[model samples]
Target: MNIYRYEENPIITPADIQPYHKGFQVIGAFNAGVAEYNGETLLLLRVAEQPISDDPNKVLAPVYNTGTGKIDLVELDRKDERYDFSDPRVVRDVTQNATFAYLTSISYVRIARSKDGHRFTIDNEPFIYPSNEQEIFGVEDPRVTQIGEDYYIYFSVVSPKGIGESMVSTRDFSNVTHHGMIFSPDNKDVLIFPEKIGGKYYALHRPTMKSIGTPEIWIAESDNLLYWGNHKHLLGLRQGMWDSGRIGGGAVPIKTDKGWLELYHGATMEHRYCMGAVLLDLEHPEKVIARSAAPVLEPEADYEKKGFFGDVVFSCGVVVDGDIVRMYYGVADTSMACAELSLQEILDSLVYE
Candidate 1:
């Protein structure tokens, strides 16, 4: 795969963003949703921020208090036998077998604008934040689809209840109307088709199943965007492959003369994430036509190889202009980057199974 990475690969980083709170630091500014709006490229960045803690033996977790509309800080002692701090991202309580974040960070969506696709300027304030109980944990990994004059935003909402998919739509970026949770708990990585197929709305989602199922991509049709059904399995993990561990949908499916081009992310058991492409039947997107045997984009550069989480290249959206596909992706789960691939090149790289 020929991936022309931007000269300034990491176009947006934590340092480029302003912390949401006074005593917190922005840890990640990646996994953004891309769209062309009002003659400018718009990036809906997922900004992750954690409370600043100077104490070596103590960890501070930031929790959003829905009642007070403020973030509450909780201190956890490292020596506490009840909790396990083995993972840098989360703390597991041994007694209850419940996992929680160590340096608890809240993720919110922020906007970055650019006249050209390369250089971007991040907004001072967040575009969307945790406002209700469902998103108390945070709103994350947004995928935006423009249908007619409105742009629909689909993202994961995390809380104590469980992680689910939520939707909201906006015409002018300033004000958005929340559409509530569309998919229930234990589901995420969702993207809606820009137009209905076969006289019904369609979506691609991943529902994490504990038994008799693996984390794979699935497609469903809906009469209305709010309720979806007629679920059909789309793609699964390929054993002994780079995507052997898990797979999920990435950018909103791009329509092409060949098929519905979908850029997706797959990971190895080692948790190294990479981007690949799949072509779905236009009339029946549930049917896969062809998939890439190898990754189109992977962690190669220092920026992609090292960060909050290492060896990762994940995308949420892309912008296609004529023959060029501008893919905006998260590098090492830390910062945002862009790469260009010829639409014909990506289609040529696909191998039918």
Candidate 2:
């Protein structure tokens, strides 16, 4: 497939916001989903923030608590047998034989306006912030889809209990009505189809599973938007492949005559991420007609090759105009970027052969 990256790469990087609390500092604010609403571009960013450790030379950290609305500090003696902080997945306890849970980190949506989808001007403040008790940590990875007269925003709500998918609706962009959480515990990366199918709402979700099932894309149906059920697995990682690690929906599904085309991100066993495609049957979305045998986009740019996490090209949203699909993705976990490919070309690249 032919991929064209915007000259202005790394569209949005983490900018230091005014501190939420006295002692905490939020950084590494990057990776956003894209949408077009009211002749403006919308970004749903997964802004990562961490607090300053009490000891400047030490690694001991404090986790934030939403229930009591306080920050809980946890001292981890690396040399002690009770703490094991070696694993990249999470910090573990070798002596205690348990995981060392940290305080919750959070994210919020910051609106950026772009006339040409390349150069953007970010707003001074966040569009949405964590207010409710359930959103103790923060909201993350927002996907915006315009349906009918309302703009529907799907995001991941993180808390101490588990990470869940939530939805919010907006008509004027200034005010939003929180519809609460849609999926159950241990689910995220939700992308709603741009239009309704068979008179019901369809969404793509990654149900986080520890064993038996890896992180794969799944589809669910809802009659009233709040409750989701009738889930069917959509795509999974192939053994010894580029996407052998995991896969999840990237942009909201693009509707075309061929099928419902979805651009998704996949990773390898080593956690290197790339982009791919999946085509579902128009009427029966549960039926996957075709998928990408090879990656449509990889970490080719230097910006994508190095950052907070290297060798990654993760897309949260895209814009489709006629035959071209312009995608805004996070490069190397640090900054935002843009790329373009034809809709026909992406569909043709799918492995239906």
Candidate 3:
């Protein structure tokens, strides 16, 4: 195997960070956006929290109240005939097309400072919380790209309206400027390139369809960082392959001499998520050059197979140094983990198509 798993494996867990409130408990601390700033490594962790209930049947959901500008805990009965609380993650309205009623847990981005890139100290307060109406449910899976001195963090904002992409930028990690929904609802896993190409900014995103089409990677161009257009369908699932189930952009596409190397997460029909590689044309990134016949990384470790959502290795970011790519990924949707891969090795793994 080309993967060099960190000896410590999961470096950050839910126990490492405390919940923002008294009654709420931290359920997950993973799916982080990684960046390097001021001689330290930063993990923009997706901290998931839910209200602790004494009664088993009483399910409490925290919602960001747009009217009062506060998070209101709404209680629901598991035994209620109009709803289905079978899924521990979400409550569904049995009355209306089995739609999502409320999320069992809410997620927000937090900064974890690591001087050595192994050990980390997590912050108590959320760096980006559910502030506006767009993030009523919460923000999840942040992907950071450094352009010049500022670090731009792109994340998912889940609300009753739908899941969308939102961005925020920080220089020192202390403060940030909010740039509202970059892509509208039903679009996520958006990764913006570090620099503009051909005097235009480029990005990779996945927008799901309701009645037609499977989840596939798409490319878009932007003049400014905010407004995006010139959308093109990039990659789709390969039948009977590891990514036959679904596919999305993982780490930010790394510029290479051969081409633009992208690390993406693909799932099987059984919902087993693994990491794969793809190579794109240098100038026109929308043109695909090669793809992975097999997964570059999969759920081999115990931590990757057992947790909040098992059989998953989802990466939001990585820190690159020459040939060494230090990948920080969320394990089973529970904790954060690190692995080192040679950039050349990932490129070599791709099969030219």
Candidate 4:
């Protein structure tokens, strides 16, 4: 099967996106969640902000201080440290027990509007920020779904405590009701279903266990949006496959005659991310009907192959229209890109055998 990408897509760029944090400068502005509201396409961009460094000798990042409502600059010594800072995504301590931390990439959800879903106008202010102590480190990827009149947004909130999914609701963009932390730590990539089934809410979640199990997509049932339980493993990485390293749910599940169609991201042991799809039973959300034997999208373009973090095509959202699926994805963990594929073509590629 063949997939199509928009040559003129990825409406926003670093040059077009404005910085959200006052003192810190914006760096990675990609992997945004998508939604359409009031005749406009809205993009919830993951804007990574850090201090503007002038010194060639040090790496500086901004940490939020809630009490002061300001960001504090944290400096890392590149020369003295035993750790190697060669990779943008990971930092390795060579002299020690091989300790590492993914360099600080705090995310703020900024808004950009599009009338045609190709050309967008970004807002000067951010829609969400890392305000409280729990979100001091920063917020990362976000997934948005609209059910009825209310819009439900789920995102990863990061801090010293741990990383987990949080929620907020809004009818209009003017006001948002923050429900705070909905899912516990060691969890993220939670995509709530657009509608409830059998009076129970359904969501696709990933529970991160570094040693025990790789990041896998699971289904969870909830009576209320705040509490979630009754988990069932939906999908996992295949050995020596495109998704051998880890997997997470991408755009919110799309309802089709076949089932609940989900587009998700997977990575290799080297952390090269790509996009694929899975079809699940409508009645029993945990039952997987079929899955794409191969990735629908991979890092082939120049922008996708090289950037802040290269060889990645991570997606957080999509907008479906009739038979066409307009996908918005993060390129190389640095820039936002878009592509279009046929809904039927993607479904036909799913292999049950």
Top-scoring candidate (lDDT): 3
Give the clashing pairs for model 4: none
TM-score (C-alpha, index-matched) for candidate 2 = 0.90
Candidate lDDT values, in order: 0.91, 0.77, 0.92, 0.84
- Candidate 2 lDDT over residue span 148-206, tens digit each: 88888878776657788888898877899989889877898898887779999899999
Worst 10 residues of 4 by lDDT: 96-105
Model 3 lDDT per residue over 146-200, tens place = 9998889999999989899999888888889998899998999999999888899
Clashing pairs in 2: 11-336, 34-317, 63-103
Q: What's the TM-score of each model vs. the native?
A: 0.97, 0.90, 0.98, 0.95
The local lDDT score (0 to 100) that residue 213 gets in candidate 3 is 95
- Candidate 3 whole-model C-alpha lDDT, 0 to 1: 0.92
RMSD of each: 1.2, 2.6, 1.0, 1.9
Separately for all candidates shown, the number of backbone clashes (residues 3 or more apart, or on different chains) is: 0, 3, 0, 0
lDDT of 4 by residue, 95-181 (tens): 756644434556788888999988888888878888787787778898899989999887998776778988888898769999999
Q: Kindly provide the TM-score of model 1 when superposed on the true structure, using C-alpha atoms.
A: 0.97
Superior by lDDT: candidate 3 or candidate 4: 3
**Model 3 deviation from native, Cα RMSD in Å:** 1.0
